[model samples]
Each structure stands twice: as structure tokens, then as C-alpha cells.
Target: MSDTAATSSRRLPPANGATLGAMFVAGAVATMAFDLWGQILSPGLGWATLSPHGLARSLLGRFGLPNGDFAGYFVHFYLVGLLGYPLGWLLVFRPAWRAVIGAGGPWILPAALYGLALWVFAIGGITAIAGLPFFLDFTGITWVALIGHVLYGIVLVAVLRRFRLG
Candidate 1:
């Protein structure tokens, strides 16, 4: 096979039990890190607090569903953090990144950029869906959220690397 073909074929590590477990662990830990930044650290530092539950509730309310704290937490923790974001990282972003960048360098910059993209998706898309202004009108909260998300992405990649999964 040509070098390009070989590179493409091996771009992603095989997905198996260990890999999936690592992704789950990375996702959960990263989510916890984001929650800490939003709920504790940022607030203690006089920054805006992030209420992901409220966002979840709002989205649920829009759909005329039960918008309880439990529901919100479920969406935030189980759905998005544990499943969605990790899957996006492993199955989507990593592949595209390897394809474009040839998978031979550090992942920090790409991880940060991925986090930034997620921030946009959250601020731009999720907020609008939850009936908030676009990007929260770029308020202080928006910038704080940016930092939280970047922290999340970094943590995610770091943990994955720890497992040799990245």
C-alpha cells in the first residue's frame, strides 16, 4: 500500500473494550472538571456560575417534558458528557484530525480547538434552543464558559493519553 493509504488505514486505534472504557473514563472525568470550574472555582473567583442543569431544564421545558433537576443531570452527565462528547472525540474529530494532520504530532492544540468548537456549539446552538440569546450575547459568562470548555477538552485528551487511547 502507498504511504497515504497505510496512514489512512491505521489512523484510528481499534475500538474494543479497553478503548471504550478509557473513553468513558476520560469523558466522565472531563465532565467533572468542567462542572468544578463552572460550579465552584469560577464562582469562588467571582466569575459567573454555570448552571448546566438549568440549561437542560430549559431545553426540556421547551419540549414540554418534565424539566426536573434529575432530568437535567441525566442529560448533562449521562447523555452529553459520558456518551456524546467522547464519541465525538473518538469517532469524529480524531479521525478527521488524523486524516488532515497525518496523526504525528501533539494533541494539545487540536484538543483545545475542539473544546472551542464545543463552546460554540453550546453557546451558539444549545443556548438558542434553550431560549437564551445567541452566545449569551458574549457576556462574561460566555467567556467563563469558554474557559471551562477548554479545561474540559484538555482534561479529556490528557486522560485519554494516560490510557494510551489518544
Candidate 2:
């Protein structure tokens, strides 16, 4: 193939029904893995449980919304997990990385870095928005959240790869 055609092929695939569906499923499964880590595995290992739903609830309350358990779950799971993060991965990060590196390298490192970015966004941005201290004052919960988010990223990438979508 011509160099131009090869370069174009290296670009991220356009968003379509199959791609979007795969992203959705991958995001959902990855989110579930994150929740499991936060709610079960970490606690089982004697770490503090990371309560993203509670953070979502607090943000809702700050905005004078109905900040109930269901509302929190909706915001955390539906809006952020199943929609926002996945789209950010497929639409933003993947494309930008491809543009930079020509999409020739392994995705693992990028996925891990993306997870680290997500950790910062969560611990730095989300917690602050929820009226919590930045990075929870770098407490045990902070590390726990970091691991959870990295796991989330890895799982999301793995699922996408499984579907041959990412």
C-alpha cells in the first residue's frame, strides 16, 4: 500500500454501530471490574473501600439534586462509566495517541497511562467536585483508588481487544 494509505489505516476507525456497541460493552464490563475492586476485593484485602457512588451523591447534593443511592449509582455507572470514559478512550485518547505514534506500538502502555490519567481525574477532579479533600489527602483510599482505576483501564482495553474493536 501507499504510505498515505497506510498512515490513514493506522488512524482510529470511525465511530459506527459496531464500534460504539463494543465500546459500550467494554466500558460496562470494565466499570463492573472497578466496582468489584473498590467494593469487594480491596476491602477484603483490608484496604479502605472507594465509594465512587458516594462521591457522585455528594456532587449531586452540591448541585441540589436528589442525591439518593439510585441517583448516585446512575451517575457513576451510567453517565461516567458506561458512557463518558469509554467515549473518551475511543474518541479522544486513542486518536491522539495514534496521531502521535502512528499506532504501531503495543496498546498496553498507553492503556496503563490512560488509567493513571483516569486516577488523577477521579482523585483530583471528581473528589474535589464532590467537596472532598484533594486526593483524599493522599490517604490509603487514594492508593486504593489508583489501583482500581488502573485495573479499570486495563480491563477496558482487554475487552475492546477481545472484541477486536480498539
Instruction: Give the count of colliding residue pairs in each prediction.
Output: 0, 0
lDDT of 1 by residue, 89-125 (tens): 8778888988788678878988998899889888889
The TM-scores of all predictions, comma-separated, are 0.91, 0.90
Q: For residues 1-166, what per-residue lDDT tens digits would candidate 2 score against the true structure?
A: 9998786655665658888888889999999999999999999999999899898999999889999999999999999898898887877787788888766788788888788899999899978987889999999999999998998888998899888866
Candidate 2 lDDT at 40 equals 98
Error of 2 at 22 (Å): 0.6
lDDT of each: 0.87, 0.87
Off by over 4 Å in 2: 1-10
- In model 1, where do residues sit more than 4 Å from their true spots? 1-9
Question: What lDDT is obtained when candidate 1 is compared to the true structure?
Answer: 0.87
Look at candidate 1 and tell me the lDDT of residue 133: 93
